[model samples]
Target chain A: MRTAVKKQYKVAVLAGDGIGPEVMAEAEKVLQVVADKFQFGLTLTPALVGGAAIDASGEPLPAATLALCQQSDAILFGSVGGPKWTGLAPDKQPERGSLLPLRKTFDLFCNLRPGQIYPAFAELSPLHPRVSSQGMDVLCVRELTGGIYFGEKGRTDTDAFDTQRYSVAEIERIARVAFDAASKRSNKVTSIDKANVLQTSILWRETVERVAKDYPGVTLEHMYIDNAAMQLIRSPQQFDVLLCDNLFGDILSDEIAAIAGSLGLLPSASLNGNGFGLYEPAGGSAPDIAGKGIANPIAQILSAALMLRYSFGEEDAARAIEQAVQQCLAQHIVTRDINPNSTYGTAAVGAAIVATLRQENR
Target chain B: MRTAVKKQYKVAVLAGDGIGPEVMAEAEKVLQVVADKFQFGLTLTPALVGGAAIDASGEPLPAATLALCQQSDAILFGSVGGPKWTGLAPDKQPERGSLLPLRKTFDLFCNLRPGQIYPAFAELSPLHPRVSSQGMDVLCVRELTGGIYFGEKGRTDTDAFDTQRYSVAEIERIARVAFDAASKRSNKVTSIDKANVLQTSILWRETVERVAKDYPGVTLEHMYIDNAAMQLIRSPQQFDVLLCDNLFGDILSDEIAAIAGSLGLLPSASLNGNGFGLYEPAGGSAPDIAGKGIANPIAQILSAALMLRYSFGEEDAARAIEQAVQQCLAQHIVTRDINPNSTYGTAAVGAAIVATLRQENR
Candidate 1:
């Protein structure tokens, strides 16, 4: 750690609830292995969140945890909520109480939900064999902080209303986020909206078009949300980066996850105006499998890879982790979630990935 | 000259534009055959609408077309619009000027978009053979007259906003429509909304819960819109009826169609509180194949079947028409759209369907 060649980074690891802690532990093991191999020093601070935080401190996102996260270079978030948190008020739920609040506090504006089916598991797809053979990698770059989710809502005597509002400045920033993402990947972005019907969508399309002039390296296309919904299944491989508002993003992101068939293989990143982010697996805590040690940990380990690339600018370390995951998947050293009869435990899969990294170094 | 025991019904036919006239002709031929076989008298009235109306009377939905529809028992509508009417202002477009006005005039509050994969052509599905072989038949009963589509929307200096409001009464009626449809099918209804996020959706869920008590014979379940989106592909056969708001319907209905592969096999109906309705094919006018006599007439013919069942109370007649269309598909008597290498034209397909009816009668 004292060597001039070594770089040090702090990560706030909030293992929220249920299977979250188990998955987080395995992810940390991978992070440690990569840190040693890449000559990087990692200092991880464990924090309680969601139901765990509620049990210990009577708050979902405790002040201590938030304080720790504010000082950290990155966040490695595990899934939150379980049957134990079911009786809480809607706002007090793990999602509304901790996740949304964390994103809001950090001013996270862009949510990247990337769904890619690893070639070894293409047969697991719900789509036709011929369709799955084409392969699919769609990154839904969603504007998280604005649009209807943050708009004003109210009730009247006979009616209840929620407003869907968007501003030019808000739209421009999200558009730039999407274009930059496209440049790094497929160099294509499909901007989704209901422009033919809604005024917000019309403005969204217009604003995205104006912002496209800055990114001459990326190609731009427009699709109605309705058609985009159908095209996701009809030809999911045709998509690259699907830029959407909060509501559409929530729906389409989940749709893409189901299309991939292997939910455990997916990871997500929420980025602020700067490149800093909270990286997490795009799945929920499995209360049913909690403490059983059989829950899938690959998504969690992949989230750590995303944190390296996006937060620490450790691209080499990120690729090493990602390639190790592909190696484990190819060898079928996965947890029961990916294969019903899989004998590997959460720890075993994690150890396999780290061993792969060591083997590659040899 | 008239048989006193025979019943008669007036049908106003609007063969709108492009492939509309060709498909409408085949549908009428089937109607003529069914009327003769069922001992029912038929009176068909032709009216101009869409681009054809625009060319004839300088309006998309002319007074003459409106007058004809008002006097008819049921309206059999074909596809509409083409390149010829592309220069008009937004409001004067064929869809906004004609179809919307007709729906508004008729007080059509409920839209039924039923998607069923033709049994013989299940291989055409984009879903995995294992997934599609489950045989999906989901009916999306949508509230057409209310919700955000009809709510107040405006733009200000810094923002553009749309209001999504729902009254209890509006939710109850649409819920009832879904439950009734479910009762006739698999006896299950999945009400979809973003209740946790939108206040309108909260009220919607509450109102639907209140209405479910009246439908004692039907099973009711609630799902957030995002989960429902994933479930549609993850396990499509699980759904019986999907009751949604206008915007959700606009997205999910199209999604269900894509699941089934060919849009030509679907038909839709828009009805007011009463049973009177306007029936139409689910696909759009194919200007590319227009006047080539090769457009698929099955959807247009099925629209007539929907008219018989929903509007005229001719259930047996409707089933006969439906079965006949199925036979046509089974026998490979389909248009080029359904089977590109086929020699079957618009007229040949119609004649083939009529021959099946005659054979079934024999």
Candidate 2:
């Protein structure tokens, strides 16, 4: 008798603090079910991070946790930071210490923020009836580790300055990420910048254009940042992928996420030049609702699904988890954040998605 | 018979191109009536600028026009540029050549964008039902002359850089402008910058704090640009005045204007430290709607009101003009953009406001 071998992969899971563990547990359970259904071997190595790690080891990003992530194929990150870590030094805070260092260590230069909305949840959208009626699904591909944020900045006797610097290589890589994302979706990308004023933006536009040659199947358009912000509010559905630098991306991504109505339901992925990635919820750790059993777990679960797709290269499994989450919403199985009257707890919503996957397995 | 001495003022009107002449004619008519009623002497100087200037002369911002503006007390500018000038070089284009040079010439360091929404038209807002129910009325005080826009920019072999520089004096002036604005309104000013990340922002926050002392009546708060964007969409009415650097202002002002439903309904004023300034419709010259007689003249009419309020110090006259414009909108005496099925045209809307003012005068 011949037996099929399971494709094995090691996953590092950091269930940070507050609602992190609760949400992370549900995501893990869903991922386990997906793996079982897909015949893939997946082992989750749980570790300390954020305020939890700080309390346990007096540091947000523990050396042991870093080693675990270094050895793993992918990272499934939970929300970090809470009131407990508020007094910590700027760089030592749960968010800054763990997340920032992780991105730097992993060379996670590109962050993909997808503002996707299901048809059933469109009513929750903040847009006008006519604008939301069309629906919005825009992905903001941001160059996370560069631009003004990471530039050399200081104050002189009379003047203060921050250098917004970008190289052709940096722009090329980020542009490729956007183009690649566009190729998978609507095959259209809008490179957003202030090229009329910023020299970095001029280089960004030129590099993005040069990178577009490699993506012949993808259509490219450049838009000024101001007009992009207005257009995003006016007709969000018109944008497929918004390729932007750090500052513009920071603003546009938040704008797009807010437009989606439910920030707790959005999943984000940070990627390096290689296929390796770290996936997490776009929202922060809800310390106020910690251990309440009512915290929204959809973002965490979807993040796990993203981990499977982007890092594990298990696209079918990712889609199955995504569809399961969407189906749960259709069935009105959600947490309080998504629906104030929702009866389902975090565990219930996770179980519902797992059950959906189990049904597909049969 | 003792007669109040007529206060004399010269307003340079640059009816550049497209519907510039059409809408400007209305603004001038309303201003003339206001001057007559308010017992003031006002003279208008029609000068050439933009593509129209290029048509009459060899340059966009003709020397004669600059001299005219220099001689005038204030500038009441109409819209500029059209398809006819699209083929011109980047610097020679009407928008770049004329508008930009005018800004530099006058040191128009502060741009005021008031996103005031009348309760009667809140249905046009794109925000969620709950968000727009309160209505929005926020003024964005943008530092127009400095920051990354006017900073040094250069390109190396593979990299491009733009230096975002801000002097103490620059930040102080803009901050004072914001605090002064808040004094007249809700007495709350939110200074937006990326202080946690950028050096310039640190200077900005400090300067704004120092300036807050000068206006003890104003409540000052600092917020990140990203959070500011979210808060604008989530609860715009909470903000009384938004103080920001050039780059953030460019993005946020447009965003705030978009939130108000229509750009064509917004008025803008660019001012120097002196009372001298230029008032223009925030919306672009719609070459498409040039001679249609269906273009919205409300913005231009409102621009004239802003000129009265900011440049000429005619508060009652400005309020009267504003009330008349609002009354026109309420009465459905609006152009095609505001109300498609309405029978009113550009001339009708302007004529309606003038008639309302005449009735008020009687």
Each prediction's RMSD over C-alphas, in Å, is 2.5, 1.5
lDDT of 2 by residue, B75-149 (tens): 988888999999999889998999888999999999999997677777667776677888888989999988998
**Alpha-carbon deviation at B93 in model 1, angstroms:** 3.4
Winner by DockQ: 2
Model 1 regions lying over 4 Å from their true place: A1-6, A88-95, B1-6
Candidate 2 stretches with Cα past 4 Å from truth are A1-4, B1-3
Clashing pairs for model 2 are none
Model 1 chain A poorest 10 in a row by lDDT = A149-158
Q: Residues A162-190, candidate 1, lDDT per residue (tens digit)?
A: 88999999889888988987887789999
Among these predictions, the greatest lDDT belongs to: 2
Give the Å shift of residue B89 in candidate 1: 3.0
Q: Write the per-residue lDDT of candidate 2 for residues A145-235, one digit (tens) a residue.
A: 8899988889976789999999998999999889988987899999999988888988898889989999999999999999998888888
